[model samples]
Target: MGIWRIGADVLVCSRFTVSPLAQTMAALTALHKGRADPGRQAWLREHLPAYRDRLAGDRVEELLVWAALRPRWLADFMITPPRDDDRTFHDELRRVSETPAEVAAADLATAIGAPLPPELRVPDLPGRAAALLEWIWTHTVLPEWPRLRRVFEADIVSRTGRLSTGGWAAALDGMRPGLRWLGDGRLQINTYDNPPRDIPANARLSFIPVTTAHGWVTWDLPDRYAVIYPCTGLLADAPTSPAPPVAVSALIGPARADILTRLSEPRSTTQLVALTGQSLGSVGGHLKILLAAHLIHRRRSGRSVLYYRSPLGDRLLKPE
Candidate 1:
C-alpha cells in the first residue's frame, strides 16, 4: 500500500484533468500488455491493424516494443508531464523537446533499472523519445481522439459531480477499486510498488482518466502527483445503432426517438447535428424538449453543451 499524505494546500490546489498524451501512452501500454476490458480489447483488435498500416515507414512500432518491454521505465518519462490541460498534440510534443537531457536520462535509467544503453544515454535522448511519441500520436491516436475524448470528458464530468455531492473522500475513493481515503488526510493506494511517501503541501495533485488504463498508474512529478485511472462505463455507454422500439418511436417522433437512442453517450449539439444530419436548430429544439421532459440532462463542457439520456430516458427506451 502507498500512502499520499495530503496537506491543506495540496487539497485546495488539486484538480481533475484530461491528458491526451497520457491517454495515448496508456493505450500503447494496454496494447503492449495485451490486457484490456473486452470492449477495449475488441476495439484494439479491429483498429490496430489499420493503425499499423498507417505507420508505414515510422519507427513507432519499434518504440512501442521498447517501451512495452520496460513499462515502468517508459511510464517515468511521462511523470510531471508538460501538458496538464486540454491541449494539442503539437503542444505536448514541444514540451517533450524542452525536457532537460539529464533529467530524461536519469528517468530512463530508473525505468530500465539498469545502466542505459550507450545509444539511449545520449544528450538528445529526450528529443528522440519525443519524436517516437510524436509519431505514435500522429499515426495511431489522432484519428480516434475525437471519440475517445468524449469518453474522457464525460468521465471527468461524472466525477466532478461526485466531488461536488460527496466531497473529497467520496470523489477520490470512488474513482476505482483499491483506492481508499483513510481519513485524516491520508490516501491509501494499492500499487505494485507500495512505498509510503508524503506529498508536499505546496504540490498539486491531479487525477487523470484514460480509456486505455486498466486500473491506475501513479506518477510523482516535479510539480504534482498524478494518477491515471481507467475511465469506467465507456464501452457500455457507447451509442448503439439499433432502432428504438416501434411503440416508443410512435410516442416521440422518429427523429426525437433516434436522437434519444444516439444519446447513450453524451454528445454535443454539433455532434448530434453531424450524427443525425439534422440542422443545428432542429437538434436544439429536440434537446430542449428532452430536457423539459427530464429525459436527458445537459452539462457544459468548455464551450460545448453535452447532453446524455437520463435514467428516465433509458427506461423509456428499454423493451417493455
Candidate 2:
C-alpha cells in the first residue's frame, strides 16, 4: 500500500479546499473510461455523447486524453496543487496552459511509460491539453459546478467535524477505498505497490472532494499537496428510491419517514446531516422522535453515536 509519513505539524496545517479544475479533470477521466459509479451515471450519460461527437475526428485530442489518463497514472500537469487564493477555474487552468512544453511531454511520457506516440509528438502540448480541458469544463462541468461545489462543501463539513471530535482516524477512513490511518503517523493513501513517502515538513495538505467516481493525489513538492477523493453527488434520490410506504410516510410524516428509510445501515448524526442536507438541529430532532417511538436504535461508537433502523422500523419500511 502507498503510505505517507505525515508529521503532526503537517496534520495540524491540513485544510479542506475545492477545485473546479480537479472536478473537471476527474469527470474527463470517467469519460475516458466510458463508465461511472452509480452516483455519477446520470452525469456521464448527459455529457459523454457530446464529448464523443467533439472528439470523433480529432486524432491528437483523442490520443492525448488516453495517454494523460493511463491506468494508475496521470500527466503531472493535469493535477495542479490547489491554492487557497486561486479561486477561479481559469487561475488553475493557466498552470496547465503555461507549462513548459518539454515538461508536459515528459509528464505524458511518464504517465504512459513509453516513447511518445507520433501523434502526441507535436507542438504546444500544454495549450492543447488546456484547450481540451477548457472545452470539457465549459460544456460539461461548469454548468453544474454550483451543485458540485455544494457536495464538496458538505463533505468537507462532515469531515472537519470528525477531525475535531474523533481525530484524524475518523476523518481519513473511507475517504477512498484503500485509504486508512494506520497507528502513529502513517497514513495509507492507496493499496498500490509503491514506496512510502514523507510529505514535506512545511507542506500545506489539502483534501479535495470531487463528484466523480475516481480521484488521485498530487503535489508541488515541499509547498502544496492535494488528495482528491470521491464524495458522490448529493443524495438527491434518498427520498425517491426505496420510497417509504404511503402508510409509513403517513404515520411518521414524509420527512421523518425518509430519514427512517435511510437508516437500514447505521449512520451518525453528522453523516446524516451531510447526506440529507439538513441542519444538525433538524436531523437531531427527527432522530429523537424516531428513538422515542422505538423505530430506530442508537449505538455509541468511539466519539460518535450511530443510528440504525430498528426491527419494527424495518417492518414498516418493508415493501407492501
Candidate 3:
C-alpha cells in the first residue's frame, strides 16, 4: 500500500519548474514559443543523452524541460497560468509569504546545506535564491549531490502534505540493500542507474548501506535511498578481464525472456517468482545475465529487489 503502487501509471510529466502549476503554464508557454532558449541544445548534449529520441531535429530544450517537469509536477505548487483562475491558489500560497516559490525553494536549499544560487528567490527579489532555482532547472541534475538531493525531496514531501502513494511508500519501506544484488553481483541504484557526475573519479562507490541508521529516515524526503548507480565501471584501473558486451543477445533464453517480459512493468522478485513459477535460484541466474546484458534490471525497493525490464529491453522484447 505504498504511494508509488497507488499511482502506477500516473504519468509524472516533465515541466522544468518546481511546482505543478508552473509546469502547466510552462507547457503552454512552450506551445506558444514563450520559453525558447538556444543554450538548451548544448545543455542536452552535455548532460542528458536520453534527449536524443525526444529532440532529434528540434533544438527545443526549453519545451522538453517544461514537458519533463510538468508530468511529475504537483498541481498546487506551480505558478498559475495567466489564463487560469489561480488567483486564489496564488493567494493561498502567498499567505505563507508574498513569494511562496522563493520561500519553498530557500527552505529546500537550506535543509540540504548546499550553496544556494540566486535563481531560487523570487525573480524580483535581488539575491542568490533566484539564481539557484534557475541553475537547477537549466544546468544541473539534483542527484549529483546525494545528501542535498535527499534533503530537498524530503522537505517537499513534508510541506506538500499529500497522501502517500502506498505503492511508493511500500516500496521504500520494504527496500533493503544487500552486497550481492538479488544474488547477482551487479549493483543497483533505486530511482535510476546513471551515476551522478559529481562523484570523484577516485572515490569508490558503494551502497549507502541500509542498516547504517540513516536509512531509517522517512521516505517523504528525497535522498539516494534505493536508487543506485554502477560504480564498478568507476574502478581505478581497468579490469584485467575484458568487459562483456551489454547487448540484448546475451539474454537469449526462455526463462530470461519470460522474466524480461514480466518486468516490462515493475515487479518484486517474489511477485515474479509466483507469476513465472520459477525457482529463486533460476530467476536469480537469469537476472544476472540480463543485468550484464543491460536488459532486465533490479533495484532496491524497501528491502526488496524489484526487477523490471530496462527501457531498451522493452523495445527488444516487443518491437513495433
Candidate 4:
C-alpha cells in the first residue's frame, strides 16, 4: 500500500479545502474519458460532443492529456496543491501554462511511465494543454460551478463534523476504496505496492472533493500533499432531492417515502448516514422496514450492501 507516515503536526494542520483547479481537473478528466455519474448524464451529454470536436484537430494536445492523467498519477506541472486561500481558476491555471517546457515534458513522461512522443516534446505542450483545460472549465465546468459548490460545501461540513465526533480514522477512511487510517500517525493513501513515504514534518495536507469519480495524487513535496477524491458519500449515497410525492409520503410516512425515493439510485447504510444525517441504527431500521415491505432490494457492491427500489416501491411511487 502507499502508506503516508504523517506527523502529528501535519495531521493537526491538515485541512479540507475546495479547489477550482482541482475541480476543473476532475471535470476535464471526465470529459476526456466521456464519463459522468447517472445524475450528471445530462451534463455529459451536453458537453461531450463539443469536447470531442475540440480534440479532433489537436493530436498533440490530445496525446498530452491522455498521457498526463493516468490512474493514480497526474503530471507534475499540474500538481500544484491549492493554498488555503486559493485564487480564481484562471490564476491557478496560469501556473500550469507557465511550467517550463522541459519540466512539463519530463512530468508527462513520469506520469506516462515512458518516453514521450516526438510531437509531445515541443515547447508548446504546456500552452496547448493549459488551453484545453481552460476550454473544459469555460465550456463544461463553469456553468455548473454554483450547484457543484453547494455539494462540495456540504461534503466539507460533513467531513469536519466527522473529525470532531469520531477523530481522524473515522473521517478519513472510505474516502477512496482503499484509503484508511491505520492509527499511530499512519495513513494509507492507496493499495498500490509502493513503499511507505514519510511526510515531512509540518507539511500541509489537503483533502479535496469533487463531483467526478476521477482521482489522482498531487503534491509540491516537502510542504504539501493532496488527495483528490470523489464525493461519493453525498453524490451517490444520500441525495437531497428526489423528494417523494405527497401521496407517496402520506402512504409510507414522509421519512420512509423519502428514503424509498432515493433508492432509485442504489445506496448503502453508511452513505445513508452521511446523506441523511441519520444515526446508523435509525438508517438500518428504516432499511429493514423497506426490506420487509418489499419496497427495496439489495445487492453487494464491494464491501457494502447497496439497496435499490424494488418494482413494488416503484409502483408505490407511481400508483395508477
Candidate 5:
C-alpha cells in the first residue's frame, strides 16, 4: 500500500507524460513474466518469434534478468523520463547514458539489499546499464515503436478528456481498477509487494500511460514522482484491415469514409495520403469536412499533425 499525499500546489503542478523507454522496459518485463493483456498476448504470439530472431546476442536477456526482472532495482535507474512531443528511441537512450553513476550504484544496492554482484560492482556501472538499454532498443523495440506509439498517444488524449470534464479524481479512478482516491488531497495505490510509504507534499507527480504495462508501476525519485499505468482499450479489438462500410461511404462520401477508417490508429495527413493513395488536395478537403462534423480531432506531434476519430465518429462506425 502506497499513499501519495497531494497538496493543492502539487496537484496543479503535476502533469501527464509519455515515455518510450518506460514502455520498452515494461514490455521486456511482460515478456519475461509471460503476463499481458489478452490482446497484447496475441500480438506477442505472432511477433515475438521474429523479434527474438533479430537479437544479436544474449546481452539484452541477461540485463532483463539482472535489472528488470524485479521492480525495485530498475526503479532507481528508470527515473521519470523527460517528455516531448516527438520523443524518439535514440533520444531516450541518450538520457540513459547520462544517468549519474552514484545514483545507479545506490539504487542497485538498495534494490538487491545485499552485496553487489561481481560484474555489476565494476567501475562505470552506469555506462554498462546504458549500453544494455541501447542494445534492447536497437534489437527489439525500435522496429515496433511506430505501431506502439499510436496506442500510447491515443490513451493520453482520452484521459485528458476525462480530466477536463470530471477533474483529477474522476481521471485517476478510471486509470486502473484497484486505485483508491481518498478525498482531501491523498491517493492510495495498491502495489502488491511494495511496503507502505508516504510521498511528501509538493512533489511533482507524472502520470504516464504505457501500452506494455499490465498494471501500475511507480518510480519515486528525488523531487519527482511517476506512475506508469496500462493504456485502456488498447488491443481490445486488434483491428484487421477492412474495407469502408457502404452506409458510411454513402453518407459521408467515399474519400471521407476512407479517411475515418484509417483513423483506427492516429495518422498524419501525409501518412493518410500515402496509405489511401489520394492526392494531398483531396485528402485535405475531406479532412476539413470531417473536422467540421466532429468526426475526428487533431493534435500536434513534433512537426506533424495527428488525427484520430472522435467518440462521436466511433459511435457512428459501430455495426448495426
Candidate 6:
C-alpha cells in the first residue's frame, strides 16, 4: 500500500485549483533562490502584478526557504511503478525531470532502489501539480502557517472560478468545513465577484497577497499576534550544520579528542555506545556537546539515528 492517500474530493480540487498555485509558488521560490526561470518570470510579469513586489528582498528569502524544502516528500510515494512491460520508464526519466513531482519520485526511487507504481493512468496523474499543494501544506503551512492558512483558504474560494473543471468544486466541498466556500459557491450566481450580501466575511474570506500558479491570491491572516504552531519537531529528522571545535570547557573535557575522532564517520547513539563501550547515556552526552560545538550533525533514517562530523570539525582536526 502507498504510504498516503488523498481523498477523491481533495484530489479533484487539488487537480484543478490548489495544485496550480502550489506550482507557481514553488517556481517563484526557485526564482528567489536565484534559480529564476525566465519563462516563469515573464509569465508572472504578464499575469500576476503581485510578483513585482513580493520578489523584492526578504520576501524572496522566506519564499525560497519555504518553497525549496517540500513537495519531494509527497513525490516519494504518489505513484506505483508502470507494469514491467510498460515502456514508460525511459519517458518517465526524461520527461519528468523538469517537473517537481516526477523529479521528487525519481530522487526517492534512487535513494531506495525501488520503483514507484503509477496510481492512475500516465496521462492523468497530474503528479507534479498534486505534489505542489501537499508539499506546501506539509512543509510551508504546517510549520509557519497558522496565519497564512486562513488567507490561503479564503483566497482560494475567491479564485475558484479560474478553474474550468468541477474538480475544484468537489475538493472544496470536502475541505475542512472551516474552508468550504469553493465548493458551496458552485450553486450560487456570480459567487466570488457578486456574492449574496448576507455572505459573512468568514464565508467570503480571502488569502493575503500570496501568488501561486493560478495567479495572485489575497488572503492574509486577520491578526498579527496569534500564537503559531510550534515547528521544532517537524524538522527533527533534518540534517544540521557542523559543530565547531573551539574547546568549550564546560563539557566532555579531553574526551573531546576521541569524540571528534569517532564522529569522522557518522554513527548513531547506539552505534557509538557500542563502538566506545560507553553507556548509551554517556555517548548521548558527548553527542550533545559535539552538536553544540557545531562539530557534528544528525539525520534520522527510519528508526535509527546517524551522526556525521561537520566540515568545520574536519578542518579543526586536520594537520596544519
TM-score for every candidate vs. truth? 0.72, 0.79, 0.24, 0.75, 0.68, 0.23
After superposition, the stretches of candidate 5 with alpha carbons farther than 4 Å from their true spots are: 46-64, 71-73, 83-87, 191-202, 235-241, 245-320
Q: Write the per-residue lDDT of candidate 6 for residues 55-173, one digit (tens) a residue.
A: 35434233323333343222322222212233422332333333455454454455444564443213323443344334433443344344333333333432343334454443233
What is the TM-score (0 to 1) of candidate 3? 0.24
Global lDDT of model 3:
0.36
lDDT by residue (211-250, candidate 5, tens digit) is 6534554554556677777766353544454778899999
For model 5, how many clashes?
0
Model 5 earns a TM-score of 0.68
Name the runs in model 3 displaced over 4 angstroms: 1-251
Instruction: Pick the TM-score winner.
Output: 2
Candidate 2, 203-309: lDDT as tens digits: 88889988655578888766788888987334233334477789888988988998898898887775576556666667889999999999999998664578999
Model 4, range 1-320, lDDT digits (tens) per residue?
A: 88999989998899998888888888777787788765567777898898888778888878888898887688878758887656688877888899889989899998888999887988888898889888888988898676566566656766776788789976875677778899999988888999999999979999998876546668886788998888755455233666788988887787787778877878866566555655556677889999999999999875346999999998998888
For residues 270-309, write the lDDT of model 3, one tens digit per residue. 4444445565456667788888988877787543457787
**What clash pairs does model 5 have?**
none
- Can you tell me which runs of candidate 2 are displaced by over 4 Å? 232-320
lDDT, candidate 1, 155-211, per-residue tens:
666677667877777677556666777878887766556677888767778888776
Per-model CA lDDT versus the true structure: 0.68, 0.82, 0.36, 0.79, 0.66, 0.38
Model 5: residue 191 alpha-carbon error in angstroms: 4.5
Full candidate order by lDDT, most accurate first: 2, 4, 1, 5, 6, 3
Predicted structure 1: lDDT: 0.68
Residue 28 local lDDT, model 5: 62
- Which clashing pairs does model 2 show? none
Greater-TM-score candidate between 1 and 6: 1
